[model samples]
Target: AYMNEEAVGKAIRRSGVPREELFITTKLWVQDASYEGAKQAFETSLRKLGLDYLDLYLIHQPFGDVHGAWRAMEELYKAGRIKAIGVSNFAPDRLMDFLVQHEVKPAVNQVETHPFHQQVAEQQFMVDNGVQIESWGPFAEGKNDLFHNELLQGIGAKYQKSVAQVVLRWLTQRGVVAIPKSVKPERMAENFNSLDFKLSPEDLAAIATLDTKASLFFDHRDPNMVKWISERKIHD
Candidate 1:
């Protein structure tokens, strides 16, 4: 996963970016979901990332013995080892169940969000729980012609921006934290440029209409899908 102490340390040193200004994030895989396992995993991640502390640390999935992991996260947070704790790929029901039992409230819920699978209900649920919504595949993993869609293209044309920028702006306007992935410098700059433009109410509504109530990937609600995910090795 390229997420080890040496790799993170090397990347940090070569990144030439100030650590203080960046919102550092890392995840705890399901395989490491345990009181001791989560504690060890976080410490290892910190050592790898070459950071004294993390801005946010997330549980990577809903399955596994996360209740036990949450305990460790709470301890780490109390000790000031991590600033914020969150979860990823957790459905609203599962998240609520966790919240009911955990002492500390989660700061955020990271998920796969885009026009195709806008996750309106999930986002609303997180909001109600005071958990921020952080998007993982904000671009939907380049599936379903996201970049070439006519609606998105038209919106981009109006603002003289790329489709990517329009989508990012829409999410940001909705108060969603978007982490768009891009390897190229130009694309990275373009992605960050979403902050410069704003999508109008009408445009936001139009994008909302683009929601097909479908995900380009597996449906987490399906029991088979959940089972499949549960069986997959975190390290595999």
Candidate 2:
């Protein structure tokens, strides 16, 4: 897997955190997205992570035999192999179709969400339909000079926080769950500390203005991009 689940498993062991205290989530990748494939892939990921059960399992993308994949996931969830099952990068229309076809409502929809792509409408749709909207790129991967945004910078200054913290606070204020990427211990601490301070109404409003309402990254719906992502073979 791209994330190297074996290393993650080792780290979890080293941390000595109790399994019950940690919420683990993993995804089904593009190649193994059919009913049979998903079942095997889930076992593979579970083995790599050294876990008996997953807190959540997500279909990594909207491509492939998603219905088949969901059927497999639904079975697993009902069987208690996964506590919850969801999808990623699924637009409202596609999600609606899934809701119509499947009895299980996707517990969450992971997507590209940041100040740049606020996904206001999408989030509302998910909220109404009882699905959580989890953000994938809360910092926009530092794209568009996010670290140096004057608006976020100014807000952070008021709270003695970094721009990264301000963005995370903004997302949290909007009821969006952000999963920001961090490598070093210091950065991870900084990300966790973002929840320490509350952004004022004015600050939240200012951050709202930063929404471009479009993805800073490539559109998942674009034909060429979808084709490329759908065809990618990350594992055997």
Off by over 4 Å in 1: 1-5, 234-236
Error of 1 at 3 (Å): 3.7
lDDT of 1 by residue, 1-236 (tens): 23555776787789898987778788887778889989988888888777889989999878778999999999999999899999988888888988899999899999989988898988999988899998889888878899998989999999999999999999999888999977799999999888898888889888988788777887778899878777766454
lDDT of 2: 0.91
Please give the RMSD of candidate 2 to the true structure: 1.1
Q: TM-score for every candidate vs. truth?
A: 0.93, 0.97
**Residue 91 in model 1: lDDT:** 87
Q: Best-fitting candidate, measured by TM-score?
A: 2
